[model samples]
Target: MSKDQVLDPGAIAARLADLPAWKEADGWIVRTYRTHSWKGTLMVINTVGHLAEAAWHHPDLTASYAWVEVRLTTHSAKGLTEKDFALARKIEEVVGWQPGLEGGALEGTPSDPRFAYIKHGR
Candidate 1:
């Protein structure tokens, strides 16, 4: 299909299987990330902002002291599209990364409650 083509319900449902944290609602694919604090919420927002800007495919965000909801759809296509799924995957990856679990040089944020940030989904 073309880049801007709108995905039908079946296609959207199939695509959502790869994004368990997200769901189809209205005309958008949406996900909500819960954070440990206001700081974590801001971090999630900023991280999403950077990704959206870089991809040039922005998403609508709803944030609070401990949560952030991301809603994505292709405005030009007037519905969900590959761009929405692609960006959602990238956002999920970066937001959910835990370097500590990966045994990498970059140890992720400390487990200490004082330093904990996102309340990563299981």
Candidate 2:
């Protein structure tokens, strides 16, 4: 979808909330993750890289020794949209981190595969 189409906040919020701990501010969706170390963080970044490339949508990423922050917005749209929500969901799925949960799902494990269902959902 073209990024020019703005999304309704109410509808977008409903979808984003289910994507773990993403927050909305200044018309951007933000999520921060803490990794074990620089190596782990890079791994996460690399994984996200492939996902974003495949989706043909990109996020604003900031990474350090142990943390990675992602801010996503449809720049062309000047706001949120189904594309943004969909990307956020994919990211949350791949990273295996959920905001309130005691722990994140196991990455690289065969079970709880979110990507496996993405194509079918579409």
TM-score against native, each model: 0.97, 0.73
Model 2, global lDDT: 0.72
Highest lDDT: which candidate? 1
Question: Residue-wise lDDT of candidate 1 within 1-122, one digit each (tens)?
Answer: 88789999999999999999998999999999999999999999999999999999999999999999999999998999999999999999999998989995999998799998999764
Which lDDT values do the candidates have, in the order given? 0.94, 0.72
Instruction: State the lDDT of candidate 2 residue by residue for 1-122, as single tens digits.
Output: 45457878777767776865788889988887776567667877887788888998888999888778888888877888777888888887777743334545534323343322111111
